[model samples]
Target chain A: MHSISPADFAAILLSLKVGVTATILSLPFGFAAAYLLTFKEFRGRVVLDGVVNLPLVLPPVVVGYLLLLLLGQNGWLGALLNAVGVRIVFTWRAAVLASAVVGFPLLVRSIRIGMEGIDDKLIQASRTLGAHWYDTLVTIILPLSFKGIVAGSSLMFARSLGEFGATIIVAGNIPGVTRTIPLAIYDYAGAPGEEAMALFLCLVSVVISLAVLVLHESLAMRLARRREP
Target chain B: MKLAVEVVKSFGVFRLAAAFSSAGDRLGIFGESGSGKSTLVNLLAGTMPPDEGAIFLDDECLFSREKGINVPPEKRRIAIVFQHPHLFPHLSVRGNLLYGYKRCAPENRRIDLESVAGILKLEGLLERGVNNLSGGEKQRVAIGRAILSNPRLLLMDEPLSALDDELKFQIIPYLKGVCEEFGIPFIFISHSMTEMRLMAERVIVFEKGRIVQQATADQLARLRMPTSQVGYINLLKLGPPRQVDGLYAYSWGGGELLLSFPVRRPDSLIELSSKDIILFKRHPEAISSRNLLRCRVVATFEAGNRTGVEMDCGGERLIAEVARQAAVELEICAGGELFAAIKASAFRELG
Candidate 1:
């Protein structure tokens, strides 16, 4: 209650950076996976779907362990990555990677629901009007499913802000670096006589999450108004 | 333009196999619902490839399973007007009209934006959104959009089937506007015989996904094979309508037809049901009926519970359905001249 602590400022800023980076970097894959799941037909589609959703049901620690063996030094992929002089373990890049992995399923599930809700007749109509499949996807499917995209993006952004279990295992709690709000709260809660700092960090998380949701709601409403037919 | 199509496709228990070749622009395909008319339209538009067949349009192979030549809908130089005016809701009328226009190459393009807008009478509604336009107006904009794409041919899948009767007829003339302006061949698929007669120079009748008959208008009328909907139809040219005794008089074929509507269009299509005309062997005088045509019977046959007579009146063939007892009592037979008495009502407008 005395003043703004340097540690709290660093944690908040780091949290925002990781959440935004995770959202922007994972968006393309999320869209591709959701659109593919909604439209395409091939063998093992259900199996591929299950694989994308595994992160949602499986424990976060298990996910972090898999990432560790795959990306850590002396591991198969890690050794290859080290050869390229790119060390991601115990760094901010690893923090973003962990957040993206944890939040991707939510993003894809919401976008897929959006794509499924579109009227299929419109897609067929577009094709008949001299538009290729790719053109139809961009002009008809994406514009109509924009609401779902907004909902998914905001949900993923909020989820990434609160990521903790997997992020701690992979990125570690390096102060002024990979330590985000959740990690900072965990640190304060673990110390003696630091309950105030923990509660302040919790309040900050709630405010940021609420702001994102409110902003998303307003933008979604504007887009929907423009689409009234 | 010439079209040759022989295709076979199956969906679950339903199968569609149609084959026909014609060298006309204003062609009509008529069939009942679920008779694969829509599927045939899709095959023509190149949106759905035929399972096993070939389609040739003016020497250009649109689809060939053997030759591996399947031009997609985008590159086929074809346009479609569906039953519902499936306009893009997010796009304004201008955007909807310009979508294909911008995508088409300049060499393939012939009709410009302003010409189509003027022809379809959509010049004023260019900026309006689809939701703001009426059903008729939306259909007009749809026609404009299809024409502006500079298609070599247009595929109309019951485009006017969604509108009401008066509205449907009102838009029929608009179709003529396009036909006269662009001279682009049209393959119209519809279930209504009235619509087929109005738009088609050559008619192909479909039943259960098979080509039952393909002939001209006169040849089709002669083949009155008693199919429930379009048994025997006589088209009359409507003259200027005048009200008399609270009924409207429309003159055609050296006579007049009385109706209830205040129809004003001259040369409009009026369909008279053959089953409603009463036969008079003695030419009864002072009868309540208005139309009493002296005709020579060309043929007579058993049609259900009645006698079907194909009569010729001044180079025009007419079909009249008379009861079996009346026909036997009047001694109705082939090559016998008789008077056909018809009441003042029983007239329907097709377009």
Candidate 2:
């Protein structure tokens, strides 16, 4: 194993930061999307479902390109942000955005499955009991889908840690600002006589992924135990 | 609750067109599966929208396609005890019971959680999670939850269909007692004639998505006797039993009934199938049946291949089914005397 450098350590910390930020920001939106897709009937439902899942099937590089087009300087969203004296492109925020967009589908899909498994009669009972739809969602649907939320969050966080193609395109790989562990590993693998450093970063990625999976499994087991007799 | 409903709903080839006015507190919607009983419940509870129709409860318009007045389910204040318990799995027994009570409007709330829990006998199980509850206990919690909502009308959609015979009988009392104690009118939905008779005073019979008949629950039972596999069930309420010879003797309708099954309750209900009674024009010297009641023929009605002999035994009314040929042999007529023989083992104890 090679000794860790300042840049490598920054990469590890930035990866954790981006993963946490992205997961936290996407939680509410992902929950809403899942609820809408699973429970409600509305026009353009199928289209919304397709749009939410497009990122999952599309290549990360392609998604990165689309995010670049949507948030780049001359883009409508970018122009609106510029009016407010804010810049998203080529910053750590852009990297978080890139990771969020790439991992959103997985989160929504998991939560949607959880919501769909709920018995229809239970929802009907809640409504007839004088609970409005939102009240039922908060009390019944949210608590029932806790396992799915935990699982999805872990998946999205893990995905964000490995996010590289989209971050490099939209956030432009800046060593202390936007470079994550995967990006740092890519830089080391491309240099001469830096195989050991790349291997060390690869070991770090494995350890983080394993830790996330173990945490997810423990959470899911606890939930299962609590739900059973 | 006086409910007037004129609703139409369709799903592909099946269309439900039902209209009726029920003023009774205990109204039974009796129908077999796919006969639109559940659909009507959904429409009345505001869970499903009617294509075009109107619904009024106690002269208050709940839905009117012409007037564009459609109240959502939460605002309608009609709660249902579904076939399955359907208790919120994520909640404890207490939480599930209070889920609706907390949301109920203050002025509308009449029943409190403590009272409901007492009525349903759910106090001990309140803090426990719903997952471990027995089927009967879970159903009690479901009933408690619905009752605590303080709705004007309770819709029981085949609530007992999911339980075994013992559990079904156990839950029926809580269902009836809670509604009666709280003064909440209910519409009981079921295909079981016995259940309908026990729960509802008046019944609306549905067949193939239409209202075929509206009559008292007993009338409906007698009307369908020939077609029903179990025939007409004669529900009898008897006083506490005394041991006589090897059987339990119960003082019944102006007479005594010897039952092979012993019951310990002060007052017990027993059911005897109409086919179980054998009528004889003359008292036979050699008869194996234990009880012989001399009854006068009140009226005779023809039901398919059998003649239903409506007899007045002392002051109680008992209907006995006999073959049409046997009826002619006995020369059965109104206001005529006849001997009805029944075995001690024929009486089945009920909850």
Residue B186 displacement (Å), model 1: 1.6
- Of candidate 2 chain B, the 10-residue stretch with the lowest lDDT total is B261-270
Per-residue CA lDDT of model 1 for B1-351, tens digit only, reads 899999998889888999999999899888889989999988888778889999999999999999999999888877888898888888899998988898788887888888888888888988777888998999888887888787888888999899998779888888877866888889888887767777888989888888898887545654553554556677776778888988888765566667766654664667788866778787786788767778889988775676788888765677887778888898888989888777777777665
Q: What fraction of the true interface does each of the listed models get right, in terms of native contacts kept?
A: 0.54, 0.91
TM-score for each prediction? Answer: 0.90, 0.96
Candidate 2 regions exceeding 4 Å error are: B264-268
> Which residue pairs come into collision in candidate 2?
none
Docking class of 2: high
lDDT score, residue A225, model 1?
Answer: 74
lDDT of 2: 0.91
**Residue lDDT tens for model 2, B196-233:** 99999999999989999999998888888898887889
